[model samples]
Every structure is written in structure tokens, then in C-alpha cells.
Target: MRQGRDNGFQAPLWRAIAVYRIAALTYATILVVRNVAHYQRPVLAWPVVAVMLAWTVFTTYAYANPVRRRPPLLIADLLLTAAALAASVPVVGRQALEEGKPTLAVAWHVAPVLAWAVAGGRRAGITGALLMGATDLIVRAHRDQAALTGSVLMLLAAIAVGYLVRIAEVAQERLQRAIELEAATRERERLARDIHDSVLQVLALVKRRGAGLDGEAGELARLAGEQEAKLRSLVAARSVPADGDDGTDLMTLLSRQESPNVTISGPAEPVRLPPGTAREIAAAVAAALDNVERHCDPGTRVYILVEDAPDEVVVTVRDDGCGIETDRLSQAQAQGRLGVAQSIRGRIEDLGGTVAIVSAPGQGTEVEMTVTRLT
Candidate 1:
């Protein structure tokens, strides 16, 4: 299954910021409309109001897309905010500026501070807040102690919000990583179960049968006994690290399935496969051997050849035993025996591979499994 990004908080956070911007714009508009007649140049102040309204709409739209909230737009936004604060001087008259009366921008000045906070964290937030606050002081000419306190509050708010956003982003990233690790763990456990049921059982059977045989068969049994130990160790050693992709040498996994009676041949170079895919293919091969052990003579020789082609990997398991009659499989299926159908064909088909069995009454049996590797 594909993992999803932890962006659950993103939409709500942006929406809250948008709502705050609109509310601040409304508050600024009310302040301007109420004090228009008191301004030294009402005409100049009216135009500034229009500009503020336009900027509010533009920033609201632009900030919705993360791409537009970067340095270029944020810097422009700060400039506009500073310009608005400066514009209030001539518009509100020298008497109002000296007395430190409320500017037309009012609460709307917080928008740029928020943008910087969201974009670049605490440092950017403090920088933006200080720039806008300094402009407010310059426009006022005489700083009221009340206005200074408000400026300090704005600075604190910017730092707090920026720090919180940074913390939230870090938490979200960790949550995503934990989710991926859990998925990988579950997949590995499932693979372990499947391997235990099919592959380990077949290896144990080979070891047991080979030990009781004589001469060449006994030597084959000794090899099978050694492989059984190696297979167990390999399975125990398999680990699903945090990265999710567990790399395994397909040849090494396949080679462990070898016994004296069943000879395995593959390339000298390691055939690397995704851990899950390699496990399934190996289990499918084991299922094929299980069928041979149950139906054929104990001494019947089997050959397992692995070919790592450019476009696909092919594995052929051939046994020199009495071949299967065409009706035997159907009869077995009808009687509720699905070893070949479910264990062999079903496993291969699930891995997006094909399994072809070439068998006739007097002829030996050969199961060819092919899995495509896309470039």
C-alpha cells in the first residue's frame, strides 16, 4: 500500500489564517471609514484605503497556494505593509501623527507578520514584525507608550506562532515515518508466516528423507541437512529497517532450497530483488518441491534453474518422475486438494508472474515460473 502525507493540519491552519486576514481587513476598513473626516488629506487617505483592500484580496488568494508564500511574495507583502504605515502620516495630519493616533492599517498590519511566520519560522517572523513595527513608529513621529507595548505584543505573537508551526511540521514528519515503519513491519511478518508454512516444511522433509537414503541419495541428504540449517538462519536474520525497501540476493535465497536430489543453478552475480517478491518466489518454488516429494519417487532427481533476464526472471523446476495425467489435477481440485492450484499458481499469479506446467502421462514434469521486472 502507498503511504499518504501527514497534511491533516495544513488545510485547517491555512483556513484559520485566511479568516483572520479577512477579519483584520474588515476592522481596518471600519477604522478608516470612521476617521476619514479627521484626516488632513482625506483624498490621499481614501486612495490608501483602496490600496489596502486590494492588497488584502491579493495576499489572501496568493497565500492559499504554498508556492506563492515564499520570499518574493512575502517580501513584497512586508513592503506594502510598511508603505501603508508610512502613507498614514500625510493622510492623518501632523497633529494626529504627533499624538500617536490609530493608523488606517490598524490590525491589518498583522497579516504580513503571519505570512513570514508561516514561511520561514521564528527568525523571519521576528524580522517582519520588527520591520512593520519600526515603520509604525516612524509614521507616528512621537511614540505613545501604549503603541510601544502593542508593538512588543506583535513581536511576541510572531515569535510564538512561528515556533509553534516549526514544532508542528517536525511532529508531522515523524508521524509519517512511524506510519511507514509500521507498514513495513506488517509486510515482513506476513512474509515470514508464508515462508514458514511452505519453504521451511519442504526443506525439513528433504533433510529427513535424504538422511535415511544410501550412497548418492545419502550425500544429497547431507547437503539438504546443511541447507536446512542455513535457511533457518537466513530467515532469522531478515530485518525490515526504517527505509522499507529490504534488499535480498535472490540467488542466495534460492540456493538455500538446494539438496542432493534437487540441484540448483543460477548466475554468479547476485540477483537482487525486493524482499517480499523474492520471498514469494522462493516459497512458490518450495511448493513445487512439496508436490514432487509427495507424488514422485523419493529418489527422483529434480533440477531448479534460475535465469535473471533483462526484462524478467525465470525459474524452472523439472523432475524426472512419472508425469502428471491431465485429469489428475482436476480430480485433486474436485476432492478439495488445492496444493498446486493455490500454493503454486496462486502465489505466482499474485506476484504478477505466470506459472506454466509442462507435463504428460509418461513424460516428466517441469514447472516454469516467470516474473517480469519493469525498467
Candidate 2:
């Protein structure tokens, strides 16, 4: 069985197991001392008890270290505890056991079952519990309600501990994600302040001075003003609450680009992805559109189709514009103009996705991107 990461998140659980071991050991020792006179071999019983004491002390310290809580340690603990429990057949005669004499290990054997559950989760813990429980039953010469009840109780305890550990690990993951979101929010606020103080102020001044100017100067001012407004909106940032629990929806971001010339089509339901992943996909889509806008004539219609499947997402961006010549893309890369390479392919490939661009001299161009869903 594979062990969980050796983090201190489960330190309290380990400590509780250690405390339980010591307490169970003490109780078992008291029982043996009180019934020593009735045992088949009194001298042999003392050595078995001594072995249990030594093992109890060793495991109390060994299990405290996360690194040592692996299969080798857990397996050895279960086997050794089972051996001690089985030793009762010889130390205390079968007749004495049938007369209701307690086993040599008594309640001390359940410690390893809990250790298994904590280290390898429910399945591993249940395995240990069943093995120990069988050993407990075999040690008894007589069968009764009390004997059966002890095994059932140990199995139930193991299941409960396993579930608790799983819940704690999930809670830890959510807390870590929250910390990252808080840090991102703080960074956005700082950048917004800096942009408002400098870049936004300069753009506002440029617009005010060039508002009355004619020809090229007025046109430049208008473009600058448009960029400023877009920048402001970008800095404002989106509220997490508005995007639902799965970050920003890819469909929501792409649908915003729709216009008379740009037609968007996708599933009626939202296509959600992780926040960072959704942003990268949207940016890649934007880059593809920008390519079409730069090379195509005004109002040359474009079609965007989104396909959301169980295992993957497929987005196709096609434009009814002047397609590229065979060597144009390679030439652009050689000239250090990497708009397609960096913005389109780079973004998708970084996310473990793939992009395919098809074009011809007179035919329209098509860019298909596939991003696999992360489980």
C-alpha cells in the first residue's frame, strides 16, 4: 500500500494513536497480572508481556515520525501484534481461554489497525483490522457475543478514522487555494493604483488636447482613449463570486467577442475551466481574431465554434478572409514577428494543449485548438 505524504497535517492523529497504544498496553498488563495464577504456563506469560512492553515503547516513538510511518513499519506492527495475540494459546491453556481468560495482548492489538488507516487510508486500515480481528478470535477456545463484538468495534473505528483523514486533506487543499486567491487580489490592487496614477493620467491629457485637432492627430487621440478605457476595465478585475466556483467560464469570456461580423456558437450551458486555464484560452482566441482583423478586409465575417465534451474541449476559429500564402507564416517567424507562434500556439501548448492552423492562397483560414480536461 502507498503511504500518504509525511506532512505534519496528521500529527495529532499520530499522537492520538500513540496515546491509545500506551493506555491499551497498561490495561492489558493489569489483566494479565490479575489472572497470572490461572495460566497454563505462568513463566512463559511474563516474557510475552515483556516483548509487548518493549514493542509498545518502540512504536510510540517510531510512529511519531512521519517519514517512518510507511508500509514496512505498519506491516511489521500488525504482524508482531498478531503474533503476541496468538501466543495466548500456549501461555494460557485452551481450557483456561474457554473459561474466559483474556488474551495476552487483549485490547493492545488495535493500535496497528489505526496506524494502517492513518497511513494508507480506509482500505489499508480495514485490511489490518480484519487480520488482527481474526487472530483475536482464533486465540479464544470459546465463542460468545463479547468476542464477536470486539472485532466489529475495531472495524468500525478504522472506517471512521479513515474518513476523517480524507476530509482533513480535502480541507487543507481548499485553504491553500484561498491563500493563493488572496495574494492574487492584493497584486491586482497594487497594479491598478500604479496605472491610475501614471498611464491613465497621461492618456486622459492626450485625449483632452487632441479632441479638437483635425486629421491624423485626432485619430491618434481617439485610439489612445479607446486603449485607456480597455485598460481601466482590465484593471478593475472580475469578482470570483460572479464567475461561480470553477473560476471564469471560457464560454462567457469568448461570447463577449461576438458582433455583427463575429458569430459565436457553443453549448447552452457554461463551459468552465480553471481560472488561469480559462484566461489563457481566451487570450489565445483573441490572438487568433486579431490575426484575422489585421489581414482581412473590414466586416469579413468570422465563425467561432466551441465543443465541450466530458474528457476535452475543442474550439475552432475560422475566418472568411484573405488566407495566407504557403510560406507567409514561416517568413513571419523568421522576421521575429511571432504573433501567431507566441500568442496562439505558445499559450495553448503551455497548457498541454494542441493547435492546428490551416490556410491557403485564396481559401479561408481555420485555427482549431484542443485542450484536454484535467480531472
Candidate 3:
């Protein structure tokens, strides 16, 4: 998602620049009035002061909108500053220039540099400062120490302000990311609560009822019991934050579902997985167990095996219960009973994994789930 631009420093920086522009205009007007008698062309001086005042008012309005501070406007602003500096040579004459007297614009030239710094960071600031500084030196026709000193100060101000602007942008980006993460966490917690109140409770009841039954009904009850345990573990673990590293150990989480009727066997070492992939695989296993509990005998034996390969992880859930007929799944789907399709197959597919079910009418059922790490 695109983040909103950070304007945290905009108001204060522009406010200060507006004040500086007005003050500089006043300063320049006073200098012009004081030096009017010394000018070779006194008549031309008043018109230049009038132009400077008008431009200052226009820039103050233009710069208030960030979109107006683009390259074209910034370039024009610098050009205008240079023009004002050049006008001093004609209006104030060579005597004042040689004496290092402040030009008609005085501190007004800094407006362009400050604008560039706020809009384009260090590079643009340096460009604007250099343009103004070089123009001032050329108009003076000599390396006046005061002029050089002013140029150096302006350069330093541009660099510092530009650096601070960059820092603020990075801080704003991190703030946006933190906001997105908090929102996602809240949504996950809400979903977990809803699942607990409905799905988890239903599976627990099915497990309890099938405990003492015989034949396929007994096997179905046992399968329900295993699924109830697995789902509960998944829901509980999901409520807590997962490790930010590779992921939580898959074997450790799956082991939590082990019970008298459910045998879980895996490697002794930790089998790591990305947190999201691990949770989906665990949930798929729970759904497969739910299927067994609803269809197989209560005393049916179930085995869960975990294999950690170099590039992928594989989990297999097997049940020695009355097997599924060839058309059973099709019939279930047609009847709008989507427990197997949505809960098991749909989940694995969404994770870029594969689900393979092997079963027959009298034979046992085996579901193999595989997810690659690259996904």
C-alpha cells in the first residue's frame, strides 16, 4: 500500500521561510532607500524594489503548496534571485559593490535554497545555493570576503536542512509499516475467537460421543478426538506471536496433538518452517483428522509422520478405518458439505502445496501434504 507523505516538518519550515522572505524584503527596501542618492540611476531603483516585493508575495503563496515546489518553480526562483542580485550592479552602482555594502535583496536570496532543500533534499539544495552564490560573486565583479562568507553559510544551511528532511522520511516509512502490522494482528485475533466458539467446540463434541462406539462409528469418534486436539493446539499457538526467525519448530507444534489414539512420529531435531506455512499445514492435518473421526471407526488407529527435506517439508496423516469410496468426495461436494474441499484441499492449495489422498472402500486412508520452502 502507498503511504501518505509526511508533512511533519513542512508547516514550521515554510512558516520560517515566509517570515524570512518578508523580513528580507523590508531589509532590501531600506537599503534601496538609504542608497538612492548614491545610485547612478536612482529612477530605476524604485521599480526594482517594487518587482522584488511582488515576487516575494507570489513565492510565499506558491511555496505553500508542495506540488508547486517542483523543478520548474525552483529553477525560476533561483533565476529570479540571480536577476535581483544582477540588478544591484545597475541600481546600486559599482561604488557600493566595491565597498561590500549589502545588495538591495540583502538576505532575500536564501529563499530559493530553502525551497530546494525542502523539496529535493541535499542535491537540490547544493544546486540552488551554488546558483545564487555564483551569481552574487559575478555581479560583485570581485571576491568580496562578506559575499564569500554568506555563500558558505547558505551552503551549510542547505546541507543540514536537507539531511534532516531525509531522516524524517525514513521515520515516516517505519511508522507506516508498524501501523499495518498492528492492524493485521488484530484481525487474526478476532478470527481465532470466532473459530474457537464454533468449529472447535463441534469437533470436541464429536470426539466425546464416538469414544465408546464400535466399528466405523468408533473409528470416526477417535478421528474426531485427534482433530479436536490438533485444532485446539493450532488455535492456541496462533494467538501468540511466532518467532521472527526461520519459524517455530514444526515438530514441536505437531507433537502437542499426540494422544493415546493418535501416534505422532518425527525426527528428534527441530524441523523449522516459515510461521505461516507451518500453521496452514497444521490446520490441514486437523481437517484430515476431522474427516476420519466423522467417517471411520472410533477405535481406528491413526499415524502422523513428519519428514523434513532439504527444499521441502512433507506430512502424512494415515487412518486404519473404513476407507472412502471413489465417488464419496464428489457426493459430499455436491451436497454442499465442503469440510474436505475447503478445510483441507483448499488450504494446502492456497499455500502452494499439494494434497494427495489414497483410500478405497475397505482399505485404510492416507493423506500426504507437501509444502516447499521457496514458497
Candidate 4:
């Protein structure tokens, strides 16, 4: 995901440079026309015209081809601005010598201040101010009443404009980064919620059942508790796949199903299972616990175990509650109660697994589930 975003971020730099080149040239051409009359003398007008054209062409080419060529463009822009300002010196001198006071002819040379702000930023703005100030000083050297204060103010204004443009660019970049982080965080939270409601619910029941047993049942309960703890740790761990399809720990799914009120028992080691198989088994375990919670006494405990081998994984969920009567069990199923059939047995069936119930009068209930893992 990050690689794709980086590629997108870099894609526009070259294109933007290319467009800026055309825009800079167009701006230079308009400036030349507005000051055409002052350049009636071929020696003064032609040289300034040539320098302006060169500045426009060189800057355009440097910025257009490659976005990574920023250093070269920066150097070139600075050099071109210097050359253009140098050419203005002769024209400014001729205008000042002919006219008694400073005229608009010299003012025309300061128009490049806008270009400096657009292309080079704060440093360029400051450089442009210094260059403009020098030219103004040269033109006003012959006049007694020419003010230096106005030239200082103009330089300060150009520098301020450049800083503002640079600040706006920085703000835009920060805003884009903030948006991407927010999106990634939201996706992580959504997946966490799904895991909590489904797989985690089943593990809680198993842990509860494990806490109430004795002897082998007690050992099974201890194993389930371990599995429950592992699942909780995995969920809290940052190593989980960002996308749920990357993979999921089967034992972790079962562990997440645990609850304080429900005792559980399960396998000692994690039983590797595919995502589909694990999802079904986890869902079945949850439905079984839901039955225990809803139909059995509040104090009932459950036991869970996982038997995994080369071809299949099996899960057993048992509850120490009043055993289901044969007639009542049948009646519960007939009255549109699909909790066990659809939520438990049906899910395992979809994953090529089998579910069986073992119970009799005066005895607790047990559910055995087997899912064949396809290599």
C-alpha cells in the first residue's frame, strides 16, 4: 500500500514542471510587449529582448523534463534572473540619462519579482529584492530627490509574497499525510471489531468450561485457558496482518472466544488450519456456547478440546448443564430454532466437517465437530 502511494506522489512532479515552463515564457513575452517603445534603439532594446527570451527558454526547459531535477532548476533560475537584471542595467541608464527623473521604463524591470515568487520561493524573492534594489540605486544615482525608502519597501514586499507561497505548499503536503494515516487506522479498528464479535466469543465459552472440570477435564480446561490467553496476546500484538486474508492463527481465534463466566478446555499446541476452516470452526464454537448461555443455568461450565492430525481438525464442546431431553431437543429444532443446526452444524458442513451431539437424561451435553483439512 505504501509503495503504491509513493509512486503516485512522484508521478505529478515532472508534469507540473513541464506546465510551469510554458507559463513562465508566456509571462516574459507579455512584459517585453509592454516595454516595446523604450527599446526603439536596436543596441539597447535587442540585447534586453534576447536576454529575456533566453531566461524564459532556459528556465522552462530545466523545470519541464524531470521532477527530480530540482537542484539544477534552482541554480538555473537564479543565474537567469541575474542575467536578465544585468541586461536591464543598460536600458535603465539610457532612460535615466535622457529623462530628468526616474521613469516607468526602469520600473518595468521589477516585473520579474512575480516570477521569482512563483518558481524559486523565499530565497529567490530575497535575491530578486537585492537585484531590484541595486538597479533602482543605479537609476536614481543621478537624481537628487530619488527615495531609497520606496526601494527597501518593494524588496520587503517581494520577499513576503515568496514566503507565503512556500508556506501554502508545506501545509498541503501535511494535510495529505494526515488523511492517509486516518484511513489506515480506521481499517485496523474495523477488523478488530469483527474478530471480537465472532472468534473471540467462542474462546470465552471454552475457557469458562475448562475452569470447572476435574482430572482430565481439568487438564483440558487448563489447555483451553492457555489457548484463550494466546489469542488475546495475538490480538494485542502489532504483527497481525493488516488485511485479514493474509493469515490468522487458528488457536488465537478460539482463545478470543473465551469469557469469565464460561469454562473452556482445548488442545495444548496450536492446530494449523486454513482461514475458511478456522472461520467455520470458530463460528460453530460460538454458536455452541451461545446455546449453553441461553438454555443452560447461569452456573453451567463448558469444556472444549481440539484434536488435530494430518487430514482433519476436531473440536469438542461440552456443558455441565441439564442434559437436553430427547423430545424437547426435537421440539426446539422444529419450532424454527436454527441456532445449533444453522450456526453450528451448517457452518462445519460447509467446510466439509461433521457435528454430533451426545447426551442422555441426568447427564451433561457434549458437541463433537470434525473438519477435514484439504492439503
Best of the candidates, lDDT: 2
Which sequence of candidate numbers ranks them by lDDT, best first?
2, 3, 1, 4
Q: For candidate 2, lDDT tens digit of each residue in 1-375?
A: 546465457888988998999999999999999999999998999999899999999998898777787878888999999999999999998999988889989999999999988887788878888998888998896669999999999999999988888888778878877888789888878989999999999988888899899999998887677667667756763435225566668877886576556788998788888888888999999999999889997567899999999999999999989998998988999999999999999999999999999999768899999999999
Instruction: Tell me the lDDT of model 4 at 374.
Output: 85
lDDT of 4 at 122: 67
Arranged by TM-score with the best first, the candidates are: 2, 3, 1, 4
Best by TM-score: 2
Q: For candidate 1, write residues 277-358 as lDDT tens digits.
A: 8888889999998889889876688899999998889999999998899888889989999999999889889989999999
Please list all clashing residue pairs in model 2, or write none if there are none. none
Q: What's the CA RMSD of model 2 in angstroms? A: 5.6
- What is the model-wide C-alpha lDDT for candidate 2? 0.86
| lDDT value, residue 173 of candidate 3 | 65
Q: Which stretches of candidate 3 lie over 4 Å from their true place?
A: 1-8, 211-375
> Candidate 1 local accuracy as lDDT?
0.80
Angstrom error of the Cα, residue 169, model 3: value is 1.0
| TM-score for each candidate, following the candidate numbering | 0.59, 0.74, 0.61, 0.44
lDDT of 3 by residue, 32-132 (tens): 78878888778998888888888989988887776676667778888888888889888778877787766777788888888788778888788888888
* Model 4 lDDT-worst window of ten: 1-10
